[model samples]
Target: MKLLLTSGGIRNASIHKALLDLLGKPIEECAALCIPTAGYGHPMGSPEGAWRFVTGRRSICPMVELGWKSVGLLELTALPSIGAARWEPWVRGADALLVNGGDALYLAHWMRESGLAALLPSLEHTVWVGLSAGSMVMAPMVGEAFIETRPPITGEDRALGIVDFSIFPHLDHPGFDENTMACAEKWATEIGGLAYAIDDQTAIQVVDGEVQVISEGNWRCFAG
Candidate 1:
């Protein structure tokens, strides 16, 4: 499977190029399904704004500008329960899956309970694009440091384990809460495993088990 995990969304030409490369086709021919379930537990000024934030319209705008034909939002929470038959076709039909960031544990919970995790491995042709909590949920566990800002809703620490290493998103982002280099360092040390600290301009690209760091700003990896 191909994964483009970012702290923020695509913020530079190189990351955009990396996404295009993963798509293996012109943007106009690609279709993407944006999953915004992660943002449900987050604090927001208004429901509408929260919806917009979780939908990640700003992040998907670049793809639209590049001529991406179809980009739509999918809220897994709207479903009655865990069932692949209802959503599997939508996921399979999309060329890419864009996951937004919010509460990692919440996202992981829905992914597990909704059977999304089980369907992911079969989506060999779909590129997985993750932002913040979206990236974190793919790892074995999420960094505890984020609890300082947003508490966990699922009460579960373990993530999907789709990827071996953990990710610390928005590292050193002054405008965001619970996002500092020191927090990343502390979380990496606590996890006692490899963790990547990536900022808005950086991303980790994984393809067929091969990992590559794509960045336009700065990033660091902590080995614990």
Candidate 2:
């Protein structure tokens, strides 16, 4: 599956280009799935702004829109519990999935509780795009700083483990200087997973079982 694990959202034209590059050539041919912005701490915002900005600039956003067949996972929260009738075809026919940013922990629970976590992996052919918390929740563990307002990590708090490594996105965000790196180092030691330190505008693309750095900014890959 093709995946773009961005540090956060796209910050500029160059960054947007990298995302399209990671995904594929004909942006129109690819069906897009957009996870709601509930997790990005900007529930009222549009994580798609970055996407629309880029694709609109290229005059190709509508081509990728899946018409009425597209589904939003946030809306699924309102659906009846497990015993309810099966979901619509668009939810199942989605060719690509974009998990936007937000509270990593909340997103995790949402995924598991809503059955998206289980359902997603079954879409082996689907391209999964993750940004910020969207990316963090895919990793085996999340960095501690993200839980500043929450309790400590417990076994139940662990992420989906889709990505074996722990990622520290928005490395340029203030208050995470030397001490934050030290904290990341400590977490790396304690958790025993590979670490990624990526700048705000950077991203890493994992495709066909290979990892490559994208974006115009700098990044570092740390191993335990």
Candidate 3:
């Protein structure tokens, strides 16, 4: 399986191009499965909010030009088994899994409850794409120092574990400071996994389980 962990959206020309190259298709020809805010459940969001977010009329514009089949597990409230089946097949048949940005803890919970965590690893054929919180949650620990909101973090810090190391997204971007980087490095040292401090414009792609750093900007990795 291939994993691409990115900062925000595919707005960066290099990031967008990398996604296209990895999927091995024209953007429109590929199907994308988005898992936004997985733990809190889709019912938590008012249908209107869910619609706007998925359609990308709000924060972090979604790359809809890349065929996005709305498999929003949270949005399907009061549904039957058939509904899950409907959602599953599109994702199962898709070329890639595109996890949208949201609260990292919530997204992780959703993955566990929605059975995506189990299913994803088994699907060796599909590419796993995570953006922002999506990328953050895939690591062993998401750097809470980088996230602005204080979501109710439960006792656990288990991320998707798609990558062996933990990552902090948007590091060194304009407003961020070296202090935050220090905090992240400290956290990684405590966790005993490598820490990748990534800039917003950068991307770390793992193909066949090997990670390749792809970006012009600089990033620092802490491992001990």
Candidate 4:
């Protein structure tokens, strides 16, 4: 499988270049399916607030800026009742799956419950592009030490385990709450496995289980 896991969405030229390289084509020729399920489960101050947050955050601007041909938004909440086979057409048609960030555990639950997780491994031609919580859910376990949110509905700590390591996103990001280098350091030690702490400017690219770090800023890996 090919994966591009990022602390944030495609943020810089270097990351953009890396993504294009993975696609092996110009962005203008690529089509992506944007999954915003993680952000749906996040708690805002109120229901209206949450709605606004989710709606406002749902945008294909980044991909459009990169010259992608088509970008479709697929919300997980709307898919649980639908048959998994119904989604195969969309999944198979896209060149990449762009997962947005919010609550990692929530995303994992839906990915499994909605049957997306099982279908992903078979998508040999589709690149999995993850942003923050989207990236974190691909690991065996998700570190919650730095996340400021309500507990997940699934009440499970383990993730999809598509990748063997854990990821700590937004390290030292001043704009976010409870995200710091110190928090990442403590979490890495507590989790006791291979972990990466990456800033918004960094990404981890895995091609057939071979890991590569693509970055223009700071990042660190802790192996315990």
Q: Model 4 segments beyond 4 Å from truth? A: 45-65, 146-154
Cα RMSD to native, each candidate? Answer: 2.8, 5.5, 4.2, 3.0
Sort all candidates by TM-score, best to worst: 1, 4, 3, 2
Q: Higher lDDT: candidate 1 or 2? A: 1
lDDT of 2 by residue, 59-155 (tens): 3222223232343453335433642246534555666676666667667766766677777656656666676777787777776656532423553
TM-scores of all candidate predictions against the true structure? 0.89, 0.71, 0.77, 0.88
Off by over 4 Å in 3: 38-52, 58-62, 65-86, 143-154, 176-179
Tell me how far the alpha carbon of residue 152 in candidate 2 is from the true structure, in angstroms, after superposition.
Answer: 12
Global CA lDDT computed for model 1:
0.78
What tens-digit string does per-residue lDDT give for candidate 4 at 34-79?
Answer: 7767866666324553343234342422432455688776767777
Measured on C-alpha atoms, candidate 4 has an lDDT of: 0.79
Candidates sorted by lDDT, descending order? 4, 1, 3, 2
Which number leads on lDDT?
4
lDDT of 2 at 85: 43
User: Number of clashing residue pairs in every model?
Assistant: 0, 4, 4, 0
Give all candidates' CA lDDT scores.
0.78, 0.61, 0.65, 0.79
Candidate 1 similarity to native, TM-score: 0.89
